[model samples]
Structure formats: structure tokens, C-alpha cells
Target: MLNLEDLGEEGFLERLATWVKTRNPAVRISIGDDALVLRDGTVVTSDSYEEGVHFSRLYFSPEDIGFKAAAATLSDLAAMGAEPICFLLNLFAPPRCEIDFLKRLYSGMEEVCGRLGVEIAGGDSVASDKLILSCTALGKTTDPLLRSGALAGDLLYLSGFPGLSRVGQQALRRGVEGFEDAKRRHLRPQPRIALGIALRGKVSACMDVSDGISTDAGRLAKASKVKLVVEYERLPRHPELLAFAEQYGGHWDSLALNGGEDYELLFTASHDLPDCIADLPIHRIGRIEEGKGAFLEIGGELRPLLPKGWDHFSK
Candidate 1:
């Protein structure tokens, strides 16, 4: 029997995707892309966050857990350039879980939802050995951004810094001091909802950086059937993360490239874009070309940019 460890996450998903066939014409986008885009402009996406896997009680509070879980799910909708309407949350918790803890978690979700004018429609709950939160976000967009729209010569852009979340996770895990900015980024990531909405019809393609630049860029490249050459030096790095690396001795470039869960926007455009969108600075880090796979350009050399980010079955 083929093991999940042998297939890995991408291989397993590729195999699973073959079994999924969309017959409904209303589904503009079915198995592929960030979210499902319906004919009536309704965009939907779902994600699950499990304790110990996605988060840990050592670093996350009840509020942080709920907020980050919801933000991660909503980020998918943002990738599709959709405005969120509402969300449904499914909670799986142990019987011993405190009511106060659950309430505080819901409050955190509400805080993020309120900022985007999203409502918690409703969901189901069940008792489990561990805690798991699943969120399904609904949104709408007249022009949805697809990962397959990228073309040759399009400039690649990334909003905000990467690797801060990984830095934060390390800091907390190692009991290191300072790096407050990095910790906050990992704990309460702000999804680029407005930026995605603004990118409609302007960018050639887009997606959120939930799985790190190397992995996410590869997905975009494969979907669009093009090559993405990313300049290693151009990848924006947070000052805090840089300082952390300098102090603790870690490769900032590797972390920035492979660190996942940044929840930032990674996009491509064929034309010149403004330096900032709604006051958010966007960095042009690379360009698309007629080829396949993703590459890292450094020291006048090109190297394959493999997916080293989070993979559920990579063991």
C-alpha cells in the first residue's frame, strides 16, 4: 500500500483531485484555485486548524486561536479577490474544555469578522480528544482572481514581510526574548482582504502566502504553466526577523523562503503598479517567464525553488 508519507501533501492532493469531478456548470472554479467561484459571483472556501499541528497552547491563547483560524480561512477568499459576506465555524473540542475558553475564542473570531463586516452565520460542534477549529468563509466578486491567469513577463509582487511567523514560532518555542513584532505577526495575522479586492482586473494572477513563497509560487507557476524567477535579495524581510537571525544564528533567506503562514498576498501583474495599495507597501520581487516551475536567482545563478514549507504528510 502506498503510504501518505511517500505521496506527500502535493502528490496526495493531486491523486485526490482526480477523483473529484465537477458536473455543475454553476461552479466556475471547482477543485483548483484558492476558493470556489460560483456562477452568481459567490465565492466559498474552508480551512481547518488543529491544535498541536497548526497551533500550540504554549504560544496561542483562546482568542489567538480563534482569530488566526478565521483569518487563515478568510485569506482564501481574499486570494480570489472577493469581499467576505459571512463565515461558518465548526468547533471540535474535548469535553473538558472550558466554556469561558470557547467564548473567548468566539470573541476573537468576532473581532476579525467585524473589521471586514463579516458575520458568523452558524455551525456545528462536537466533542473530541483535541481541539480543532474549521472555518468556511463566503464572499462575492464580479471578477475573481485565478491562479492560472499568470503569463510570461508579468511582474511578481509580495505584500508585507515573510518568515516573521516562523521566527515568532521559534521564539516562543525556544523561550527567546524580544522579537515582539514577529510574535504578533504569528499570533494575529491580518489577511490582505483590501489588497486582494483592489487587485481585481489589475493583476494577472494572485494567491495568499499561506504556504510560503517557494511552495505558493510553484503552485501559481504550475497552474499558469509558466516559470517564476524570484530574486532572493528582493524578498522583503522583516527587521525583527533579521535581528533575530543575526542574534540566534539562522539563515534569514531560508526562513523567508520556506516559512509558511504569513497570510500575505503574492500576486503578478503585467503592467506597472503603484508602490502602495491602500497604504500597504507592495514589493516587486520577481518576474514570470515562458517555462515551468519556480526558480531562485542569486549570485547570477538560478536554482530550483523547491517547496520546503509546511506539508501535512511530508514525514
Candidate 2:
């Protein structure tokens, strides 16, 4: 009954623009071959990746490397409740790196690009001591969601359960069994693209929990000038994360909150939720308060869980 090509590129956009005309009244230009479109306001974000720092070749295949790189970049756009449309890539590779390495990386990017329906508009490549990949992503949203938009009495939510990535990393490094979810999480973290796009005006504030919950929640609190309370037990910890945490030292909890690659959308809603906010397993894990007392609660007891999320330049 429905097809993408029924309208052509320009006609499809015209139809889409008509569909969202009530929300984004500013999308004056869109689709068509002769002329492009524009909006009064825009949101843009950029991210970078280095060989030894972000990932290791011994663990991540070249294709996975490219997918992760592009996914990480596009994930930021999702946090703003925007649909990723175009992205640019810049790569720096060492002389010793083989050509297959680069092509495979692009192949992985191509796979995700197909899924997102985005194009690698343009970028640059050069020689270096190590691999340095950077991406600048573009998104379309007249009303871009930000962390500062949250308010008191709002409910805090996460798009999916936590600690899967932690489990995945452990499974890969320690050969820990019973970690398929974790392994898949680590190998292919899917940013909640549909959920984010649907959130648009429905969510008060939004962000991707890349660096973990405690850290990212703290950022939301600071930005909104309010307090964030996360219920630890209510935090839908992956079914086996506790066991993995026991076997992996304190790293499991650490990874769950600060591991820096989960790529799930963390958001706040001012009132009741709707069915459109679907895709991942959404959970109402916490709430916002009037003060600056950002902390976490376990069961019924409240405690302070400092925001020590991953920061590349921190001391």
C-alpha cells in the first residue's frame, strides 16, 4: 500500500514536510532536484575516534570499527531528538595499515548508512601515526531537544536496560559465557533512532547515555538547574549483570554507569508518556526534583552517586 519511491525524492519530502507541517513550520525548503530546503534553526555535533584510545584492532574487526565510529557520531544527533540526514567522515591512518582495513571500514559505514538512509556527503583522508576517525553529523529539527529543558517533577527514563555493553566487553575479554546480549551490545550498539525522532516535542530533555547513567544524568541535572534521582534497583540492570560484576571486580558497576559506549537515549518527560515512544525497552527509572541534590536510590534508600562518567581530558 505504501512505497518510498512513489513520491520521488522531492515528492517524498514534500509529503513528509506536509505531514510534519504542524510541528516544524519553519521547514521552508525540502526535497526536489532543482532547489533544496532550509530551516531557521539547526543542531550539529561532531565526534572523534582514535585507534588505541577508542578501540583496539585485536578486538574489533575493521567493519565493526567503521560501524562503531559512525554509530557513535550519529548517536549524538539522536540525543537531540533529530533524524540524522547527512554526515561527513575524516580518517587518518598510519602507513603500515593495509588497504583492506580502510575499505572494510567504509563497508561497515555503508551498512549503517543504508539503515539510516544517510549519505557520507564528503570528507578527507591522510597518513598519520595511528588511526584517527572523525565525523560531523547533520540533523533536521526545528525544535532541538537539549539537556537543559528538563524541569522538576519530570520523570527520568532510559530507552533500554543497562550493563549489556559491560557484559559484552567482559565476554570478549574474559571469555565469559552467557553474554550474548552483552556481546551483541558491544559489537553493534544500535542508537535508538526511531525513538529519538519520535520524541521531538514529546520529551522535555534528551541525551544519549554514552558515558553511563550516573555521569550523563548528572549532566542533565546541571544543565536543567535541578536534581536527578536514579533508583538503582529500579534501573533495569541486565538479567546477568550482577554475576558479571561479581566476576569482573567492580568494573561491572563502573561499566554500567561510566563505560562510555552504551549509546542508549536518556531522556526526561514532563508528564505522562505515549505509545509512540517505542523501539527499545523504555523504563521509568527515576524523577527530577527542585534542588541540586543529584543522586541515586537503591530499593527505598537514597544515596549520593557522584557523576564520574568518562572524560578523555580529565585529571
Candidate 3:
């Protein structure tokens, strides 16, 4: 029998996508991208976190774990420019885990759901050998944004700075001092919900930077059927990441490009961007062109820059 371990996440997704035999008329999107879209303009996404694979009690608090888990799912809705509606939380925990921890975890998710006006519908709970949590979110919109709408000559923009998540993760792992901002960023990433809503009918294509820009950018490019020429120098670097690089010994730009879990939005628009939206701190990082792949321009030299982001199978 075929096993999940044999194909890794992406490989498994690819094979399963090909095996889909039926296509539902109500399903606008399925088996790819950030979420599934219904014909009724509802967007749904789900994500899971395991005890050892995603977090550990040694570094992440129960509350933080709950918060980040919700954020990951919300980020997908944001990518589709969908408005918050409701969500379901599935919990899998060891027999010895604390009840208080579960309470705090639910409270953490409430912190975000309350702010975003999301309702906790309901979910399933079960016993397991380790703590595993999943969040499945539902959203609604009049017109949902897609990743395959970019046309050649559109300008690429980023909602916020990158690299802070990686810096934060490193700081937490090493128990570094005086990097509270970085640590906070890693512990609780804010999804660009407002920005995604603002981008409706304004951008040609949109997606969130979950698995690092280098990797996610390629996915956007391929979906849009165009080549992206990214300007490395123009990529925004957060001040916290700069400080982290100065204090430690690592290349800030390289780290930013390869780091995952940033949860910022990456999008493309025609040159005629609106003044208000363009005026935002949105950084122009690249432009789309007629081609089949993505490339990076560093110091006037153009070269292929494939994704070196996180991959479950890439050991």
C-alpha cells in the first residue's frame, strides 16, 4: 500500500491532485494553493501543528501555540482576500497533558478570533501520544482574489518586511537576550487581513509569504504563467532583522529570502496602482515578465534563484 511517508508533503499533494476524479461545480478551487473556494464565495483553509514537528513546551507556551495555529489558517484566508466568518479547532493531545494547558490554548485562539470578529463554530478532540492541533477556517467574500491572475508587466509588491520570523526563531532557540520584537514576531505572527481586503480588485494576483519569499514567489510566478524578476536590493528588511544580523554572524538578506512563516502578503499589480494603496509601506520588489520561471537580479546580474525554503521531505 502507498504511504504518506513515501512521498513527503509536496510530492503527496501533487500525486493526489492528479488523482482527483470528480470536480464539484460549487468548488471553485481545490487541491492546490492556499485554500479551497466555493462557488458561493466562501473560502476555506486548514492547518495543523504537531508537538515535536511544530512546537515544544520548552519554547512555546500553550497560549502561543494556540495563537500561532490560528494565525496560520487566517493567513490563508487573507491571501484570498476573504472576510472572517468562523473556524473549527481540532485538538489531539496525550493522556497526561494538563487541562489547564488546553484551557489556555483555547483562550489564545480567542484572543485573535475576538479581534478579527471570527466565531468558534466547533471541532473534535481526541487522545494521542503527542499534542497536535489543527485549525480549519471559513471566510466569505463578494469576489475572491486568486494567484493566477498576474499578467506580464505587473509590478510585484510585498505587504511588509521579511526575515523577522527567522531571526525570532533563532533567538528563541539560542535563548538570546534583548530581541523581544523578534521573539514576539516568531511567537505570534500577524496575518495581513486588512491589507488583503484592501487589495480586492486592485491587484492582479496575491498570496501570503508562508514558506519564504524565494519559494512562495516561484509558486506565484508559475500560477500566473509569467516570469518574475525580483530585485534583491529592493526587498524590504525589517529593522529587527538588521539588528539581529549585526549582533550575530549571519547574512540578513539571505536569511530573509530563505526564511519561512513570515505570513506577509506578496502580490502583483499593474503599473497604475492606486495612490492610497501604493502609498502604504508596500515595497515594490520585482516585476513580472514573459517567461516560464522566476529569477533574481542582484547588482545588475540576473540569475535563477529557486526556493531554499522549508520542505518537510528535504532532509
lDDT order, best first, reads 1, 3, 2
In terms of lDDT, which candidate is strongest?
Answer: 1
Worst 10 residues of 1 by lDDT: 271-280
Query: Which pairs clash (backbone N, Cα, C closer than 3 Å) in model 1?
Result: none
- Model 3 alpha-carbon miss at residue 123, Å: 0.6
lDDT (Cα, tens digit) per residue for candidate 1, span 1-315: 999999998888889889888789988998769999999999999999999999999889999999999999999998999999999998999999999999999999999999999999999999999999988999999899999999999999999888999999899899888999889889999988999999998999999999888899999999999999999878897898789889989999988999999999899999878889967889999999999999999987999999998888998
Which is the better candidate, 2 or 3, if ranked by TM-score? 3
lDDT of each: 0.92, 0.75, 0.86
Q: Candidate 1, which segments miss by more than 4 Å at Cα?
A: none
For candidate 3, write residues 1-315 as lDDT tens digits: 866667656667779888886567888888667888898999999998888777767889989998989888899999999998998988888888899989999898998888899998999999998889888999998788888998998999887678888898899999888778777878899877888899998889999998888888888998888998889988888888888888888898877888888898889999755434523468889999998788999999988977888777654
What lDDT tens digits, residue by residue, belong to model 2 across residues 83-154?
778889988989898999889998888888779998888899888999999888777777666777789999
**Most accurate candidate by TM-score:** 1
The local lDDT score (0 to 100) that residue 122 gets in candidate 1 is: 99
Q: Arrange candidates by TM-score, highest first: which order? A: 1, 3, 2
**TM-score, cand. 1:** 0.98
The alpha-carbon RMSD values of the candidates against the true structure, listed in the order shown, are: 0.9, 12.1, 2.1
